[model samples]
Target: MTQLNNVGIIKKANIYFNGKVTSRTVLFPDGTKKTLGIMLPGEYEFSTDLKEEMEIISGKLEYKLSGHDWVTIDGSGIFYVPANESFQLKVHTVADYCCSYLNE
Candidate 1:
């Protein structure tokens, strides 16, 4: 696990999947924003308005980018979701992740 230092004010947020997934928005002192969330075992599709980097903190998930093959991601793994695109994820176990919205 990567150590995070000084994560600033965090505010809770209910994300998509009809509240199946929940996250907390972290506002850093450096003006960066991130969403830390957990996903229960299920299949879900997500759309991104901004480019995102999703890091798997624990458990595992199988995900397929748009027009790409499914790949399994374990703990500490990271994946990128392009802006204005969507991806599908199939979680077999409870997975925890951090999504960092990139400034383009």
Candidate 2:
């Protein structure tokens, strides 16, 4: 069975960087929000204090939690990030990912 959405897209934001980086944010229902970011061949960081993070959509990414060992994650994977922790995502090549978090 499939469910159809009755509401509309609340808010959307897009940013194109000078390099090969780009990002976008989409707000959905039930205080759920999604952000898509494209990174070039470089390192980046992800941090938050909120505890309710849902999933991540990625093409290819290398992540390190609190300066731990680098973990490579490709394609699509779901992850639950702990609260009050800082994480980093290092882009080896052209990588894009979507992060779903609680908007409230």
Best by lDDT: 1
- The global C-alpha lDDT for each of the candidates, from Candidate 1 onward, is 0.87, 0.61
* Candidate 1 lDDT tens digits, 1-104: 56557877465576777776889888777888888899998999899999999999887899999999999987659999999999999998889999999988
lDDT tens readout by residue for model 2, 26-61:
656565666666778777665677654534455667
Model 2 CA deviation exceeding 4 Å by range: 1-21, 52-58
- Model 1 — TM-score against the truth? 0.87
Q: Report the error of model 2 at residue 11, Å.
A: 6.6
Backbone clash pairs for candidate 2 read none
TM-score, each model?
A: 0.87, 0.65
Any idea what lDDT model 1 has? 0.87
* Cα displacement (Å) at residue 37, model 2: 2.1
